[model samples]
Every structure is written in structure tokens, then in C-alpha cells.
Target: MGLLKFIAVGAAIGYGINYITKKGPNGRSILDDITEDAPEWFNKAKTYATEKVEEVVQQARPNSGY
Candidate 1:
């Protein structure tokens, strides 16, 4: 029953994404813009995570800097 529910949910989400991304006002598929910007978004997220990790490490180190 749990597996069936998961499958149903997944299918619904897939269908919704397909429907919404089929085309945009510009006639280009929404996925085209998403794919173009994915790299930039991923890089930003990576930078944010890296900065946070460095912050945590610095906090863990005593006398590291004040």
C-alpha cells in the first residue's frame, strides 16, 4: 500500500511537471530556461554550502581567529 501510494504520487508529480513545462509564453519549453540556469543555481548553492561548512569549521577551531 505504501509503495502504491508512492508510485501514484510520483506519477502525479511527473504529469504535472510535464503539463506545466510543455511551453511558455515565449514558445520555448520551461525546461529550456531551467536547463540554462541550472548550472548557475547549482553553483550558487554549492558556494553557500561551502561557506557554511567553512564557518562551522572555523567555529570548531579554538583560537583560530579571535
Candidate 2:
């Protein structure tokens, strides 16, 4: 009984999150908005941001070695 209740709660939360994040008006997934049609500037900005995050992660790592 307890296990069933826990499973029910987990399923409810999962469904709620999935429902809440479904996009609305002018909304689109990151991949959809950023793919083929997005401007070059946006793509460059994304690349720069990704590089910055990677650099920060590297700096935080111990030696960041293989």
C-alpha cells in the first residue's frame, strides 16, 4: 500500500512538471528556436556562452586532466 501511494505521488509530480513546461503562444523548445532559422548572432552568442560555461567547469576541476 505504501509503495503504491509513493508511486502514485511520483507519477503525479512527473505529469505535473511535464504539463507545466509545455510551451504556449510564441513558445518553442530551445532546439526548435535555435536551430536552422535562428540568426547567426544568436548562434554565436550561444557558442560563446557554452564556451564560457566549459571554461568555468575546467577551472573548477582538479587539474581537469584526462
Candidate 3:
């Protein structure tokens, strides 16, 4: 029973992967879309993180007479 369950789970995962990678009528798979857009998404996230870090650093610093 345990072996059968494992096989069934494996098969389900394989099918899901196939379904995602299969091209649609527009000729692009889910993976293709992700590959195309991932760079823009990553850059946006990185910029947001950098701004937050700078804000925190500024708040942490003590006032200087300068």
C-alpha cells in the first residue's frame, strides 16, 4: 500500500509538470512566461529591499553635528 501511494503521488506530480510546460494556443508555456518576466520582477524586489535597508540604516544612526 505504501509503494502504491508513492507511485500515485509521483505520477500526479509528473502530470502536473507536463501540464504546466505544455504550450497554449498562444505558443508559450507557463515556464516560458516566467523566464521572460523573472528578471523584471527580481529587479523590482531588489530595489525595494535596498530602499528599506537604507531607511533602516538612516534611522539607526545617531545625529551628527557635522
Model 3 agreement with the true structure over 1-66: per-residue lDDT tens digits = 999999999999999999989999999999899999999999999999999998888788758522
- Model 1, residue pairs in steric clash: none
Candidate 1, superposed: residue stretches over 4 Å from native: 1-11, 64-66
Report the C-alpha lDDT of model 2 over 9-60, residue by residue, as the tens digit.
9999998767666665768644455464668878889999999998888889
Please provide, for model 1 over 1-66, each residue's C-alpha lDDT reduced to its tens digit, 9 standing for 90 to 100: 999999999999999899768987789887788899999999999999999998888889969574
The CA lDDT of each predicted structure is 0.90, 0.78, 0.93
CA RMSD, predictions in order: 3.3, 8.3, 2.4
Best by lDDT: 3
Candidate 3: misplaced stretches above 4 Å? 1-5, 62-66
Clashes of each: 0, 0, 0
Residue 53 alpha-carbon offset, candidate 2, angstroms: 44
Better of 1 and 3 by TM-score: 3
Locate the minimum summed-lDDT window of 10 residues in model 1.
Answer: 57-66
